[model samples]
Target: MSLLFENAIGDFELSTATLYSPTNGDLEATRDEPVPIDGIVEYASYHDRLDHPEKDDWIAVPLHESDSAALTGEYIAFTDHALHGEIFVYDDGDDYESIDRDAFVESTLAERVRFWHSDYAPDDPPSYFDSPIAEREPPRRPLSGDDAASFFDELESFVRAEMDAQRDANGEKAAGSTPEALREQGFGAIPSLSSLGQPEDGTYRFRIDDDGDDRAQDRHRYVQREFGIFEGNEVQLFPPNAERAPDAFPIAATVGSIEGRTVRLAVDWHAIEDRSTVGGYLRQKRRGYAVTLLLNSVPYDRELEAIARVRERDDHRALLTGETAVTFGDTAGVKSSQQDVELNQEQELAVSCALLADHLFCIHGPPGTGKTRTLVEVVRRSVQAGDDVLVCADSNQAVDNLVAGSSTAATADERSLHAYAQHGADEFVLRRVNAGNSSNDVVGERYATCDGRADVVAATNSSAATLDREFDVLVLDEATQATCTASCIPLARANKVVLAGDHKQLPPFSATEDPPESAAGMSLFEHLYADGGVYEGVGVQLRTQYRMHRDIAWFSNRRFYDRALRQGRDVASLADRPALVGYDVGGSEETIDHSKRNDAEARLVAHVVDELRTEAGLEAAEIGVITPYTAQVDAVRTKLTAQLERGREVTVDTIDSFQGSEKVAIVISLVRSNADGEVGFLDRPLDGPRRLNVAMTRAERFCALIGDWYTLRDSRGGAGDGTDLYDDLHSFLESTGRLRRVEPEFIPIPE
Candidate 1:
């Protein structure tokens, strides 16, 4: 039996131990054959029945101080425990496994409770185990003088080797490494640069870029390339303007592809390109942590204590909430006398919560409850108080929406009032910052760049965190869709944090089965909102919805929001029209296509949309199509685009994509048409209602639902049916004389 490459540190400790025929991974839980040890004895299993003091099945592997020959690492430990019983391993101590913080947090109480005896070979059985860790600080490897030099050296080597490998593969490098490639001989008046073009599968051609010959590129000359990746585009080339490039200058690329000159990236391109770039930041975050304990750079000492205060104990929740005295416009020493910026009760309360909040505040905003409008108040108030503000969201559109609302240029003569009237309301400052990975092209030229000294900076949360600047307030919009760990990036940069989002909207979709943890898949808004009311209340529930008709909104209001949703005057005017209408599309026994595409239902939705636009005298922009799947969204968009008039544009998107957005009328296509009554996650017990809630409320005037009534409404088929939302809404639709039936005109499924 041998132990090799052991790392004994705080939370992580790895070792390759062998109990059976030299296994490559973790130590065996049990052995086929036992070997004699010097003085090792197995204690009775901890769960062992008979009154054994140490009842666990774990056997402690002794620390052999006398025989240092067995271990090679400074942080290696010999006393390991093992036993492969239920959840935690417990037989032999011979395994190397990576710990998943998310998994640890999500694990059953029994799973976690059983974890201790296996990891910690305690001399005596302890009365209790500490709480599972949800977050940690970024790891710190304090650099020595040698370490700093080594970092540069390694960086240089990595850059050179990586570039060479690409150049060699692309047949671009000269016979001997150019002096320019190895080390530029001297500084050129201008740095020479080129651009990259994909000539072939494995070839990239470099062409000189004349930056009108920007003379600023003249200093250090070498061949260089900087690359950026945003939405839809895989790579963007910013060729150096210099006639020559530095032998080694920073390139804004995850994997350098030099077609340009020197590039001092705005943010760490590596972090954007590959989240797992050198540091364990991403990994720690995935495991449910801010990594606040790892490095102090990101977290202030007070922040560190605050983290512990919230996470280490529940007592702080009560204390923090009890002491919080929130009042709107009270955060800043100066209160705005501008009556033009008056807020509604919920909006004012949300701003007050943010103002009075010492650490955190949550705003529970259902769709169309004016989350963005409330956010505008917070930003203007912050700016009026002379505080730097960073507003962030999960999506680029969400951030842009916030930016448009706060910036004087976008909302100039509109409803929103600017804070700094000194520059006039039409010219108050704002910056629309985006992650380098953002596809700003779709957002128009204004998104490409903005003035740096704007009163408010709106950015994708991750990009906002790398800004190399600080802010007094951090407001995360659409916060429910971001992981708590990722949310910490922006949160750490500000003293106070405010969150706005509806938990019932889309939960974050993760590729990996193991999700990040905090309060268990509940977003930051959800976590704070859950405990806030118990004390003095750290959040204001946005209850006035202006997007959906009173009757159309009734289902979600009664079910999701406890019937507190009030329709604004605009929505109330829609009462004369039918709020909800249903169309049955499975007239022919045709099932949904293999890709979950309901062509028949999709066509009916488009047909209904055209009818609404022409007969109701509504513009195409007034209509929205909501579906459960992406395939259906595309299908509907294609169909609707073909049917609508040349200048008329309609909004078509998946249910999740339509959240935080609204249109006057909504056309929903329920794609699932199965004989077996498969509902396709729409009736997924818990998620079904939430998804349906968002789908139902995006309309202001009329809502037309098209689908298989048998699949949704009558699947269980009884008066007291144990059916779903569709069944309940189906009866309601009947009472309102809004139900219609349509036959399917089947289309071939795409390959």
Candidate 2:
């Protein structure tokens, strides 16, 4: 059998050692045995067991035959005395096999046997063992670099020769033929430069000139007879302006025959530049010429007609020898000329939107302060500047909110930015930055080109490494919630940056040790807010609470807001917004206590479904559920699935899978574990607080939390606090009405 061995190891070191071919029952003394070593090929001497450990005791050896060696019927075989019994050889029709004490082996050598050891060990064999030798016709040498190159050159010459012979096979004189005759012969059928540029000898040098006033000056010049088709059509000879040199020179021009007109030609300036320029510069510049090629025309009459049409409609004229065109705005329309009206200062997002041009703008407001709304408007204006923008969030829910809110007014070209989340790159210059599945590696790889390549790139602190690339503008949403490492790096990439978030809702995770002064001091928020005056001086603070009901906002102010006020923060100002209203679901602790766990969960799920189905009237797809722990996630998934099976249309997902996702309504299960038997919330190390926040907030139209308030409140206080867990829970229930007990009521799961 003939075999070819190609080395697949790209750059690893190669070695030589004894090789045993189990298939042919042949043993070679060294890697280069019977053949000379070539480039990157070497003889193996020692095996590194540690580096290449075998899963089993068995080891495989391979043998290669020389390409030039011819196979002969004659062969030889030999064996060592390490066998416990007699050895037998047989040709299995498919391949040759050698059996020694029931073990199989095949060899290329003809029959011959020799034994050196008396006893045989079937399980393990000694390292050194000599067997047999096989000889065949001498092998031929493989192709060399020079030989391969020459072969390809000869092949190309032959192909060209054959094509030319076929062209002239009709026994008709084709050289110097008329344009119509060339057209009939399939040489100049098209009135474009492509047809005219066909080379008689497969080679041509041509120049087109459309700038000259006279008919003769408009035509193209060809040094070789191969470009004969472009003889008459001047407009098709060169690009709009032949003298307007490109960054890379030497454009290729093509010739063809036009109906009525004798000849026509076309110039592919973009193609010429693309083929000549190296690397990314060519791709960036290709866009301009691609547009030009799509509009180019051939034939003098057609060219003149097109130019006249453009002139009649607008004050546009062909310049630089028809290779370029210039235009002046002559038409007057007030609406078309009007610039975008900036939003009023009273608008909640006005200040943050205005700071899109600032080198750095940090927005720190309490919860319900309209940070997200401000971010959306700023992103809109940033993208309007023809800049590509990337928007990313630490959580999937954040990404979803940004995408959904921004997609409303996007143009067809702008809508393409949404693909960055799925593809990890954007075709449109602007895209929402997404660290898929919380993997920073994806962000790092894609951000390498985020500078001028992308209009905007947004991601969380975990992906801060991506900010290593430079950017024109940067916006950090939910800034206060991010850790220092996650928030600070992206600032390095942007000439102008915006930071918007509520500091009171959540502060950066405190570091275990004080960081060095030179290290930018912990959190990006702290770095900005270190001096209270700096935070107050930067930008606008929106106090509107549009998300919550007025009553809820008012009540929350007295509870959560008042606490922040005690710390000298301005969180209580949102109570004035008329858009905020509150709803009260009357219930008592005794009523809630009588409800079973399953009944409580089911009632909650049904309430959410009914609200989405009837009250808010939202689609089933626009609702989600978030749980803090995997155990709770599994539990909720089961109960929700059962409810859904019974005809409810709501969908439930875990916090981990729900990142970068959004829904109109969300219900969060803050499963408080009593693993330590404490009355308050357990301070268990849980995964994905950021993920939980992202998921819970993503169902933006409405949100609800269901959990043990007491446990959560107690957990918030460090172990040093003397307060009992139940006391913490009472305080929590009084502060925020996120939890409430419900009376047992059998509600039908929505179908």
Best candidate, lDDT-wise?
A: 1
lDDT of the candidates, in the order given: 0.50, 0.36
* Candidate 1 regions with alpha-carbon error over 4 angstroms: 1-254, 260-342, 405-428, 435-452, 513-520, 531-536, 570-577, 587-594, 642-644, 717-723, 745-751
Query: What are the C-alpha RMSDs, in order, of all predicted structures?
Result: 23.4, 32.2
Per-residue C-alpha lDDT of model 1 across residues 273-332, encoded as one tens digit per residue: 443332222112111110000111221223233333343333333222233232222224
Worst 10 residues of 1 by lDDT: 287-296
Cα misplacement distance, residue 150 of candidate 1 (Å): 32
> What is the lDDT for 234 in model 1?
17
Cα lDDT, model 2, residue 237: 22
**TM-score of every model?**
0.55, 0.37
lDDT of 2 by residue, 586-668 (tens): 21121222221233444455565555565565666666766535545445555566664332356665554664345556676
TM-score of 2: 0.37
